[model samples]
Target: MKGTASACGSATVINAIATGEGGAFAIDLRVKSTVSLTGDPSEISGKVGNTEEDPELIEICVEKVLERRGVRDQYGAQIETNTELPIAVGLSSSSAAANATVLATYAALGGEIEPRDAIEIGIESAFNAGTTVTGAFDDAAASYLGGGVVTDNESREILKKIDIDPEWRVLIYLPPGRSYTTEVDVERIEFLGDLVEVARESALEGNVFGAQTVNGLIYSSVLGYDSQPALDALSAGAESSGLTGTGPAIVAVSKEKNVEKIINVWNSKEGRVLKTRPSREGARIENG
Candidate 1:
């Protein structure tokens, strides 16, 4: 049996460190994973087409879903994933991969699961693979449900979800630095307790731009990122811009008319600029 799933990367508005409240948006870059029965019943082998990423997470994802379903594998598993998003950066590449892997596993097993159950299974895989800190519920949900989502990560509950117009452009400046979720020190981020709380409130109130901007600046300052790229994006007429996760990559929000302005500012920087639109379609099965 074989199954395929397509999921997208997400830019973090909140890191889920200090306050459980967090937000994220689905981007155009997609990660597609296929899971199939393989040669050995007890073995699960996987490959990530992205060279910088480890495929063990994909294996873990399949195992996690199987374990959750209390199923003893009668056949081996093979999983292969291809992604357009940069790996190990602030963008939620891990979450996207996990989401796709989990869904693909379910399909290969001839089973169906609710979207919430699928997300939980994916988060479980993330924990088993050591790829996350807070389980990245916001990121995973945004990738799975598409569009923007505000959530309580600890509770695994979504506080709000909104669809942004596809016409809005998302400009990403990917720098050389790598900020994996596993490397973050939760205590250091928790120090900015009150600021994060205020930011979370802003997100809950539906002020996505303000909330994301505040969260980004706070995280960038604490994580030792330059934060200049984000400021530059704003100077170039971005409606909202800031560090996406912990550091390294900056995500900017702009209308189509202002895309070139944002790209121009990023072009002067050290990293490459990737332009995409926000996605409203969530993760789903792809015909194989």
Candidate 2:
């Protein structure tokens, strides 16, 4: 039997709220999609291609999972992705791709899945696929639910969803280079032990705007990246600004009236700047 499914996974900016014990909140954006498969895997074994963006990790992941499931040589499938989200730029590209591909493939296989359950499955798949650190349950949950979500990455637990004012516009700054999350020294993160508590408290108070800034500052210091641009955005009238994930990408929460101003400042720097809105809906199946 052969089957196909398509899923959309959003990009995450950071863990807004994180406990020293490891709880986190994520801001999600839906701008990328993935397709998955479950028939004649051998047909796509050597047919996969890379286009400057290193999607090889994701492809290899799918192949390995299928092979382990004893169905590697029995499927022929193609995954084509169209995305505005940049990979390896700390925009949750990998997570989005993983969720989309898994959902698509499951659909192709004639399987059924609940929305939240599917995101959980994607988290497990990503860990097994070696494509993520911390399993990123916060990011995964945000990608699945849209808007903002708080979660425990270790336990794959969702703590809460904070409703963001619709008037907010999310703007991103994309540096010319990519930073791999895996390459980040875990020691650096561990070094910021005390700061995690401060950030987590900010998130719990529903002060995500402050939470993102603090989290970004801590990570920027650890990653050896500049935090000036993000801080500059805030100074320039943006509501909130911070680095996303381990980042080369900086994110700003702004009002539409101020989006252009935020974009101008971000573009003034030596990076690509983008403006986007929060996605209200989570993942959806385009076809059965």
Candidate 3:
């Protein structure tokens, strides 16, 4: 049996580490995963393309799906994933990968799983792989459901899913390095819980860009990342700009008129710039 699926990546409007409540919006960047059952029932293998291989995350996703279906002892699988989203740069790459892998694995088993179940399975896989803190429910929901989502990560509940304006462009500044969520300083972020709450409230009130700016400022300060890129994006007419996940990458939201201006400002920096738009489409099976 074989299956293929794809899921979009997302940028943080509010990183949930500080407050259990967080927000995110989907982007056009995507991860695709293909799964094929093998004759060997005890061996599962995985490969990732366009970045470093993370066999552990892939295997965890596949194994979890097999176990959920009570077929873990009956089938092994070979999983392959490719992505335009950069890993460890806080673009929801892990969540997207897990979603695609889980969906693909289910399809390979000649069935489909609910999106919520797939997201939970992906969260479990992420925790097992030590790829996230707080299970990243906000990121997972945004990636799997598309558009913008405000979630209570602690409760694994989506409080809101906003259909974002598609005309807005998302500009990402990718620096040379990467920051993993597992390495974040939880204490430092939690110390400013009151501040993060304000950002979360702003997101709930439909001021997503404003919330993103607030979140970016707070996290960047606590995480010791240079906030200059985000600041420059704002100066260049971006409606919202901030550090997305942890560090080393900054995201700016703006209209088409300001996209070039923001890109020019980001291009002057040390890293490269990627341009994409908000997506209302979520994860889906590509082929059965």
- Total backbone collisions for each predicted model: 1, 14, 0
For residues 1-288, write the lDDT of model 1, one tens digit per residue: 899998999987777877767889999999999999765768998999847467888898888887777774666788999988888778888889988988998888888888898888889888888988888899999999899998999999998986778898899999886877778888888889899888888877878888888888998899888888888888888888888877688899998888898898789878799999899997989897
Q: After superposition, how far is residue 282 of candidate 1 from its true place, in Å?
A: 1.1
Model 3 TM-score, all chains together: 0.98
Residue-level lDDT for 107 in candidate 3: 85
User: Candidate 1 — worst ten consecutive residues by lDDT sum?
Assistant: 67-76
| All candidates in order of lDDT, best leading | 3, 1, 2
Q: Which candidate would rank higher by lDDT, 1 or 2?
A: 1
Which is the leading candidate under lDDT?
3
| TM match of model 2 to true structure | 0.83
Q: Estimate each model's TM-score.
A: 0.96, 0.83, 0.98
CA lDDT of 146 in candidate 3?
A: 91
RMSD of 1: 1.4
Kindly provide the TM-score of model 1 when superposed on the true structure, using C-alpha atoms. 0.96
Q: lDDT of each structure?
A: 0.86, 0.63, 0.91
Worst 10 residues of 2 by lDDT: 16-25
